[model samples]
Target: MRLFRSLDYATDADPNWAGSLLADGTLPSFRGGYVGISALRNSDVLTAVSIIAGDVARFPMIVEDKAKETIVPLENVEYLLNTKVNGRLSAYQWRFAMTVNAILTGNSYSRIVRDPLTNEPSMLEFYAPSQTEVDTTDPNHVVYRFTPYNSGYTIVCQQEDVLHWKFFSYDTFTGRSPLLSLGDEIKLQEQGIGTLKSFFGGGLKGSVLKAKGKLSADARKKMREDFERAQSGAASGAPVVVDDTVEYQPLEVDTSVLNLITSNNYSTSQIAKALRVPAYRLAQNSPNQSVKQLSDDYIVNDMPFYFEPITTEAEMKLLDDEQRHKFKIEFDTSKVSGPSVQDVASMKTNGIIVGNEARQKLGMKSIDNPDMNRLESNLNTIWLDQRAAYQAAKAATKGGDAHEGNSHDDNAD
Candidate 1:
């Protein structure tokens, strides 16, 4: 991996030539267009995106040393990701923004800043997907072209100098947004909302007034004004006293008749399906779901798609070959396990995780006691051989007591 990369200031490479470089092949030379953040206007979209991204951001990323079975913290990368990512964003803010960008736009990019003398990473600078482009013309050395926000110039970077996170992707380079395929559903939902707003705003109330015969324009105008005046404000619930020449007929505009409520619910479910989010996560709750069951389903089914991409890309881009062989980077998923008190106690008693490890998951400080670091079965049934020996010793003690009693009885006779 290249530890140091200088920004290429004098390159004449046109930004238009940028393309995505996949491991197997290349994609079309175009910037993966940015989907507007306005998509959050949809309630379901906002909820789905927030639940996934917020949970992701809440989980901490750590580098684990497989050889030593311990965590090795890198102040540059780990601290930046867990505490502060850059000058402008906190760890949570950075993660949330990047995830939102990836989910909405299908790609997120950040430049890795490294120290000149030590050749260690120092900062991670974020770039909007729209501000970054990839040039895959060279199969061996893929290039990144980044235009800084509100800046007039573009900085050309080597593949090693930037971190790219992608969502669901077919070509492995440019990710496909969930909204891309659900365009019709989103449009219909938005239109439905607009219709509701207009219907209520206009105060139509699904009623039409008819005249007995063709009336003059002046008469029609006066009648409409009088009708609106009577229907609004103080006279809203009162009966309208119209002349015999006019008749009122009520049209069916109930939500059930129009299928408005059901249609909106179906659209929301479709949006959730498209995003691979559980419907309950978007406030579409089912009849009888235990919290534990829902939490497990979320972690097992929905979360891997959101978590693995970022961690895998981070491991590849952040760690060098030697470090990667000895260490791995991952999020501490147990934090979001939503385990009950009984479940957590069982884990401890079974020696699945040590005290400090469990405490870390609970966001508590580690105890300094040696017992806290040890993993021991609370039931004293650790190994099969030990259990067998314990049972044998108990039987021998009982047999000895019986023999003693028999000897005492023989002596008395």
Candidate 2:
């Protein structure tokens, strides 16, 4: 929400205090001591010292002799004074290290720019503190503050671009009070969070978007099938022909009639009849003309010309190969639908037309054939024969009784 714009070094009223630490004679003892003055003279060191001193004093120090006596009194001391100075310096150094470490370790604040034209968020810019510029407790190090350039507009950095920073009441320098130095600005720019001008485009803007789901299984399968078909068609060298014969014809009766015949898939006689032209005239005209000329004339004159001549040997071979391939494909497809002839013959001898259509129609179930009518006829024949035999046997049994009665009558005669 908050954006930073420019980075300027923290201003100092007496810049010499920061520079004097570098002089060998300024604090000879402190320079050669365990904690050398030069060691704490760095930008990070000065910033740390200043931060700890707050608004009270510019240089705070403490000196203890080997006898545990105060070597430099707090008030009378000219070069080194109290312990508060060292504490302020140390605190500034510590805080700077922490901030720089966080930035270096990818723990910095970042925001993305949205592209209004694309309606999408662009790239992000991150604020990264530099180790060299970081003085955790340095008061002399330059710290930035957001000031209103205009009455209502605050000048802030929006990813190195001069864009208004939205969603925040104040700028980056106004909130949280993070200590920064001149080196910090350099490091921040180096880490890709410098100024708004350095940013390529105002960072991410627009709207958040989501990706659509993957294609359906059936759609994928269809696409693959189409691809295979197209590859096969290309490999086979099949001619790419568009049937647009009618479009070339003129509006005149002859051309219109000829084009109509040629555009349709019709025989010569059918074409002649449809066009109201005599078949003999077509026959007479065909013998004297080349197929190309005939087709061109038919298309121009609107005549029906279905047959295309094989002009080249390559074309003829390609056509022949395509036809043979199609035939083989169809034959193989049909073979999978039925059993072999041997299986049919074996079933027939067993009084079972296993693959017969009639059996399937009658609902008689069989793995080889599903016909039902034939099964009904077979069952009817078997039942009729059984019934006839039963009747004949019953008649014979009655005949014996009849014969005995007849013999008694003969003796009486």
Candidate 3:
């Protein structure tokens, strides 16, 4: 009832928690330092994130006028993106791959590298900085350093000259990787997986052997060799009864191994939630959740938030005054979720979109017919029959009244 009554939740008052309260966020990692993007690939959850990001990044980003809602190309931004980014990666690959890497590591960098002779920037060069250092003296100036792929040396550059994109940052300026949030659990899971594998794979601790008699170190090594010799591709790793020089008694830790496996499987959902993805999408089943609902959640929540930081940063850093006024970049979410059956029916019934439009969206070619663009007359004639009958009766009555006046005038004459 009084959860927020005090900020001090723990009585132990560990410095870590106290420090987090004052600091914007804390860096958490499986090791002493930050987990590299390459290292995160070892995780199933992180792999799923890359898959999801690929799906999102394939959807083309179009420049449009906010007022007209029509596509506008500003200085070949769309064309440049289509061919390649900074002349290194295709638009699709760069946007999607970099976004996935950014979500996992909370870092993406692009610089406005200019031609030497001209002051204007000729092209953009994107870099994935392995590490960055901020000059405390000047808040605006920060440095990014990373090694080029297959290069022996590291390249260092300034942040002001680069376009920085990130996700899940506590402070808007510096993004923190969401992987760090579950770093402790991930480390535990990593160890658990290793332990389970070792137990099954006849690793060092496969079993605790109890020998019958005092054996020399040479005898013990021979016994291990025989055990491995018989265990290759076999259903079981039980020790072979050879010479009776040693008797092995295995540890009864089956229950512990089973529990660890179950926990690891269940944690798939936790990882999916942290990445803002539905568990079901990652091949993890969720009872009572339909495909449509999960797909809706994908477009509604996952995709937008995934692109929020990128769009915001690009708008602020990339756009000049004139371009900002006339053009803006947006991902067409229509690629993610199309109109549902009920939605399409409603749109058709209400004549909101024409037949050609619907057909085109449904992947069918348009028909060369006049009615394809317009709603059928029957759609607008639901109440017209009754209204027409009432109008006919009223018009007849007026005509009879006019004729009666003519007859009365003739009688007077």
Candidate 4:
């Protein structure tokens, strides 16, 4: 484990020797395409990242028993995941933040703090991508160099002490940011957004003023300003007292003409694809698809890419060798794509699940009655064997009791 150092020579030290630019004192632009973390200013990027992170945050990791093939909850892991990760954030907020960092920067790092006596993991302290660097100089013993935000010192630790999640990594050490690859698309989106802002921000409707004769620079400038003022506000309908040299031709403020909206949509779609999120999830119109279809597409196609690595990393790093052999960690996505009401009802009716299990899935309270917990038969909630026994008992009671009553009635008569 490593701790803070003196800041006297920290700034003077060249970060190049530290490996990647992430070791720099300032947050460097990730791959020179977009500003690091500032790329979230683009609405599509923000939306995509939020969707993935939020989905992951909703479900905590579950520990599985390998030999029994069942999920078993570990109290410490459960508390760490469901209650709190460290002093700064709860489990949900921490997970969301880490996921956002991973999606945007292609890498997320967390220092694993262990108990001194037990040597078991006690806490996970998250580090920003900008503050963390991979020291790959030693191929055999790769280590992590972490510089805390706004701090004057750096900490160096072994690979085992840090949990690293990499996305789209060519080198096994660091992951590549998605923005680096989607540079063109992001540029197109930014340009379209700029054009839209100019269109709306400027009071002018983008109409053209034609001058057949060559006008001086000052005259041309004056004419353009006059034309814009005339076309907007109360003066819009007023007749312009321009000489015959100038003619005003009104241009419609049509977004279709500029193709900005179309280009923006295309850019957003491409970004969604790059992030492995559905276009609809980024607020793109999907008139043809239902909400359920879009949700299913997201859960089936995109979630695994974002979630599997995190869970796998947790299983490997959070647990010890002895524990790893018998237990594994997994995200509880059962509720994410759970069965529909009709499916749950059918399962209960057909005895595939008991009433209590059905109630839990449906978010209903469990019944205390023993009969409600019993397996139901396909016919009217009674088991086939129980129904048969019930019918035989009723038939014998009817036969003997009715005969006895008739004999008593005859004797009385």
Candidate 5:
């Protein structure tokens, strides 16, 4: 019995031919059939066996039930030995074949691969069997000879649920095939892996986006008009000018009221009422009282005197010395009296009283009357002594014996 089946022969062989061979018990006789036995093992057949053995080696099987038959039952043997075996074989041909199966078949056993940088899912597909050259010039390039049509299958490669894929092409030169290169897919996977790591590792989810708003034109216009109206109203309501004026009246006085007050010596209040003027104003305008002292009697007597408001030259001149002197004498012009000798003598001795009252009132003192004859005698003695001293000084200047004589002369003088 064959340990593994070839997916190419199983899928490509005629179903009727396979059924007829099974019924006729000629299945093993058919080339590349399910139960075929090779004379000398084919390289293709060995390659298939090596792939399945590698899977079993990596994940070994154990027998769970001895009584339930071999752990993988004969009923499940075809599926286990063929379908599952083929699925594992497909991985070596393309990098992301299992990932493709996960996406297409929705198999829980298969998982998507997430790219580290882009964080997207991905898968892979095999190159055609005839293509043998794998472009190795650029690390990131995957040059393949592929027919956009007639491609058999697609493989889904993933890391953490993201899907990725690579399409293959046919090469005219080499009959045997190589992998459709996957460096670009690897780079894409790395990018998606980085992005996924960031998402799970805590960071911003998407690209930055922004927006803004502004006032409408009509709203702005309305606000401006309202402001202008308010300003205008305030300006119009302000006061521009103010009124301020004064009034005057005529002043009057009664002559009869003044005459009546002067004739009867009426009270100051009665006079003010008759004249329609205030009492204080009337009193302020009245003349002050005058008093004179008699020299012979030493008596102070008040006199009825009116201070005629001195307005004329004649009245101003009445206060001058010449006019005052004329008014001072008691003269009878009708009798024509003349000056007496005693009066004339008094006037000749002293011109007039020029001393102030305090000085005139002071009495005579004894110290004021000095001895004039004694004073004259002392003055004569001083003059004689000075004349003698001068004569001696004149003699000494002529180089005479005048020292003794001068002393005698000074003593005598």
Candidate 6:
């Protein structure tokens, strides 16, 4: 029942150390590596990451057949995937949360609850691993101890039902969090922002106070108080009198002096790259061409890495062998789906895709024709029915010859 606020996996924990904890039956250290997930998320970098993932996951999907390679309209799988991934949340909302969690922690999990009588899956519950312990011997085995999810409840879900979506697992059961990999970049961004706030909040740069002549203790105290008074009244333009003996020198730092701005941009771009988000997603001012390129990268290059893995897992896990061969689970990106007109034409020319199929992409009706298999090489024109054309030509030629022979017989008579 524990609501997991953050990831609590032991990625860098030593084997011997965990063994000692087990021997003593003490809780292992829940030390999140430097820049814990909670802290990083609280910072600004995650805003872009979450938005990128959430934007992509918003497109709910349609189930397809693997063997037949067509879509299923009203299957139980559709209802489960769309209307309810969990009892409380719809598939879209749960999916959006999963996508955000995956990007943030590089890992996300869901438990599959089945009907008691039917033994068919009933709901998918996203549990926080606050009390869940991983079994080292069997990497796939996870022992979940429910805190408040259910009182006095313990459950173990195998590989089949639980969806452990991950990013960059690094040859281990625990997927390596991008936050860990891009730790330095995230720090740079966080520290960079912190430095800016500290500087601006003071409304003054670090400065030195110097006197032309040595002052008495009373004079020093008076000077200090006067300086404080001036700072307090800075907004009101309060005037302060400085004697010839005293001078105030300010220390300033322009960004160019330290390349601070460039460093900030570098850090921002690095985090974006690691999360597979395009810079423009973070509100960067990019050209249309660059935007187009990034959009292409998103759909063609980045999204499939995770989606296909789950889809492939669905084929193996969600269905029986026969159903697995006949059915497939897919995330439809048709919202972002595209190709240039020329490219679409080329696909038709190459027979990679067809006219009616392409038309459906734009929400148009299928072309009207019974001869679906007939080939029409000229894409500029409608699909030609060759058999009908040939039959008409043959009939026209025979009638012309008969008319000429009849005319010659009439002339002889």
Using lDDT, give the best candidate's number: 4
**lDDT of each residue in 62-82, candidate 1, tens digit only:** 887787555676666788779
Whole-structure CA lDDT of model 1: 0.73
Clashing residue pairs in candidate 3 (N, C-alpha, C atoms within 3 angstroms): 110-163
- How well does each candidate superpose onto the true structure, as a TM-score? 0.77, 0.13, 0.66, 0.72, 0.14, 0.72
User: Per-residue alpha-carbon lDDT of model 4 for 246-306, expressed as tens digits?
Assistant: 7766677765747746545778888888888887777787759888877877787778887
Candidate with better lDDT, 4 vs 5: 4
Candidate 6 lands at a TM-score of: 0.72
Highest TM-score: give the candidate number: 1
Q: Write the per-residue lDDT of candidate 6 for residues 37-79, one digit (tens) a residue.
A: 4534543456665665565466565666555444656356667
Name the lDDT value of residue 218 in candidate 2. Answer: 88
lDDT of 2 by residue, 128-240 (tens): 22101121123433222133223444223332221111111132221111112123332332233223333323222111222235668786666555544544534333343
Candidate 4 residue runs with Cα over 4 Å from true position:
1-19, 22-35, 201-255, 259-264, 287-289, 341-413
> What does candidate 3's lDDT look like per residue over 1-413, in tens digits?
01111345333323243333222222432243324454354566666677667765776666667775555655446654455666567777777766765665666666666557743445666665443332223456555554555555655666545667777766555665666665565666667787777766754335545567787999889867777676566556444454464556555665765675756665566677777877777678776867877787778778777766666566655566676777777766653466765675567667777776666444344587888777643434446568988778889999999999999999999
- Candidate 5: how many backbone clashes? 36
Tens digits of lDDT, candidate 5, 55-98: 32232112122232212222221222123433334333332233
Residue 169 in candidate 6 has what lDDT? 66
Pairs with backbone N, CA or C atoms under 3 Å apart (clashes), candidate 4: none
Candidate 5 accuracy as lDDT:
0.29
Question: Each candidate: what lDDT?
Answer: 0.73, 0.31, 0.61, 0.74, 0.29, 0.60
Kindly give the stretch of ten consecutive residues in candidate 6 with the minimal lDDT sum: 22-31
TM-score of 3: 0.66
TM-score, candidate number 2 = 0.13
Better structure of 2 and 4 per TM-score: 4
- Name every residue pair that clashes in candidate 1: none
Residue 48 Cα positional deviation in candidate 6, in Å, after optimal superposition: 3.2
Query: What lDDT does candidate 6 reach at residue 59?
Result: 58
Q: Quote the lDDT for 124 in model 4.
A: 86
